[model samples]
Target: MTVTVRDLRPEVPADVERFARSRHLAIPYVLWTPEAIVHRTTRTHPDAHYRSLVAEEDGETIGTAQVGIAHDSGEPGQGYLNIYVQPDRTRRGAGDLLVRAAEEHLTALGATKLFSWVLDEPGNRAFAERHGYRASRSAHFLRLDLANGALPPLQDLPPGVELRRAADFADDPRPMFELDAETTSDEPSDVGADLTDYEAWIEESWKHPLLDLDLTSVAVVDGRPVAFSAAYTDRATRYSTAMTGTARAHRGRGLAKLAKNDSLHRARAAGYKEAFTGNDADNEPMLAINRWFGYEICATEVRHVRELG
Candidate 1:
């Protein structure tokens, strides 16, 4: 059987489901649904040049790749291609075909620098290095057994603080947007991003298919949102914390922890059995918070970069 790489057919339900299924088999830690897949290819900003690719072998999709330029970065020519192949489908040229197709696409888009996330296993790292990629920073994927493991007891808010659900701000989500922008600017990432486009944020984040506003928790102080934990659920048993952050002025007060704990507790009560989150290796505070909540590191992935000619 021969493996071929091609763009995903977003309009086909079976094709979209196969793409999502391939992702689930490759990386079960995060949520992947057909709606989320379509939303990504159809709703992302035009400048990003995002395209989802699939590796087909004998009429079956065995791998998937998300290829695009980092248009939000201040630096031009930065591109990313994250590929995941079904665990049972390796050693069949599917991964190689997907990578080659993704690189060709990004290079055609004038990307001078290419980035990809490689699982930290020896074989995966070897594959990336053999393709001229060098390992850089690393990140850990943490998992919490919300259905069985013990979670930190929820704490009461301080005298001037109160816990609120993100749904409470549905009538006007601009405040949440402002808080997200401020906190996201401080996140540690290789490509610095400026979330200045309010309308884009609403379309990309606020209206995302997986965002669960009812389960999201926010810490409000004097009617102002100071800390928040955004929740994304697959409407099944898996829940992931998309983002958790506290404002600069509210740092060192443990408000972010409070928000996350509340959010996690609510998720558990709502029948979410598994929780997943990611943290940069250099991010100590957030890592500590996850550790405090009984989240254990399940996997690690290293960022690899290749300079394109």
Candidate 2:
């Protein structure tokens, strides 16, 4: 069985589907779709030098890697490569080949440090360790039974505060962009992202294929978006909260929780069955809020870093 790695061909539907399937098999907690895979491959900023690589064994994709520089990071030379091998395809050398190809690409692009998220299982951790990566931080993937679980009832809006759907800003999404930028800067991650490019964010995030604007709930104060819960759906029964945060000024007021609860209630009413989200282990505040919504930790992944010469 010969496992070879090559760049994903976005134009080829089969290639895109296989890549998405491989990723879903390896990491089922997060949502994956063919359209989302293509968007990430082709719409990401050019500075990121993004590439999607797939490992093929006899023309069947068994593993995939999303390799790119952290173009939004303040620090230069920071790269990331998240590799996932289908559960049934492990031990066939696909993972190794995909990693090698991703590392070589980033190294050639002058990346000095690389980061990857490895599942917390022993075999996955050992794989990262053998590749010279050291674990730094961990995050949990949480799931809620949207259709069966009880959601917190919507609370009365504070004076002068209103809840609105992200679709309300379709005419001009700059406010949503501003709110996203502010919250993203504070997210806990190995590579800190500075979202300063509004156009890029519009292309890569606002217009993303998975973004469900109608389901995304936002807290509006004085006609400005102060807190939001961004929702992504598969147009079926599966829904995920891509991000939920409150602006620094609005912290401690429960606006974040308000927005998220509103979003989840609507998601359930709209027939979504399963809800998924992720949080850094250190983000106790958000984790607590998720727990209030009946979310339970389903899986974990550790961020690993490898310094390059």
lDDT of each: 0.93, 0.94
Model 1 pairs in collision: none
Misplaced by over 4 Å in model 2 are: none
Best by lDDT: 2
lDDT of 2 by residue, 1-309 (tens): 798999999999989999888889999999999999999999999999999999999999999999999999999999999999988989999888888999999999999999999999999999999999999999999999998998888899999899999999999999999999999999998899999999999999999999999999999999999999999999999999999988999888999889998989998989999999999999898888889999999999999999987
Flag clash pairs in model 2: none
When summed lDDT is taken over every stretch of 10 residues in candidate 1, the lowest stretch is: 189-198
- Model 1 C-alpha RMSD vs. true structure (Å) is 1.0
Go through the candidates in order and give the clash count of each: 0, 0
Error of 2 at 60 (Å): 1.2
lDDT of 2 at 146: 92
Please give the range of 10 consecutive residues that has the lowest summed lDDT in model 2: 91-100
